[model samples]
Target: MEEERNTYLDELSGDGCRIGGYPIFVQYGPRENEELRTFDTLLLQLDCEYECDLMFGDGGIANFFINEEDLKKLDFTKVLYNWDCC
Candidate 1:
C-alpha cells in the first residue's frame, strides 16, 4: 500500500530543479490556495544539490511561481515562493 501510494503521488509530480515547467513539490502544492492555483507558470525550482553541499533545510526544494499573465507582461513583483523538505 505504501509503495502504491508513492507511485500515485509520483505520477502527479516531477521532482527536480527546473524553469518554466510544472513544479516538483516536496510537500505542499499549489492546490492548497485558490490564488496559488492561478499561478500556472513555474518560474524557477531549486532542489537540494548534494554535490554542491547546498540544501534547503534537509533535502527541501524551493519553487517560484508566476501567473501566466504576469509572465507575459514581464511582471515579477508578485512571484510566489514556496519550499519544503522531507
Candidate 2:
C-alpha cells in the first residue's frame, strides 16, 4: 500500500506531455523569454515517450504556446513553437 502511494506521487511529479496545461520544460522555463511570458496558454506539450517510440533528440520536450487572447480568437498564426532536451 505504501509503495503504491509513493508511485502515485511520483507519477504526479513527473513532467509528462499533455494538452492545454502547464509546460514541463526539461531546461529553462518560458518565463526566461519576454515574448513567451505573454503567451500564457500552453497549447501542446510533447515529451519523450520511450514506450511509444516517441522522442525529440535525447529526451527533449516540445511545446506550443499561444496568447490567451489569440487562443480565444482561434488564431494560431502567431503561436510559438519551442523544444529542448537534457
lDDT of 2 by residue, 1-86 (tens): 99998888768654778898778888887658775688888999898889999999898999999989999999999888899898
lDDT of 1 by residue, 4-68 (tens): 88987766457656787777777779657986788788899998888888799988999898889
Q: Clash pairs of candidate 2? A: none
Model 2, position 25, has a per-residue lDDT of 84
**What value does the lDDT take at residue 56 in candidate 2?**
94
Model 1, residue 86: displacement in angstroms? 1.0
TM-score of each: 0.76, 0.82
lDDT of each: 0.82, 0.85
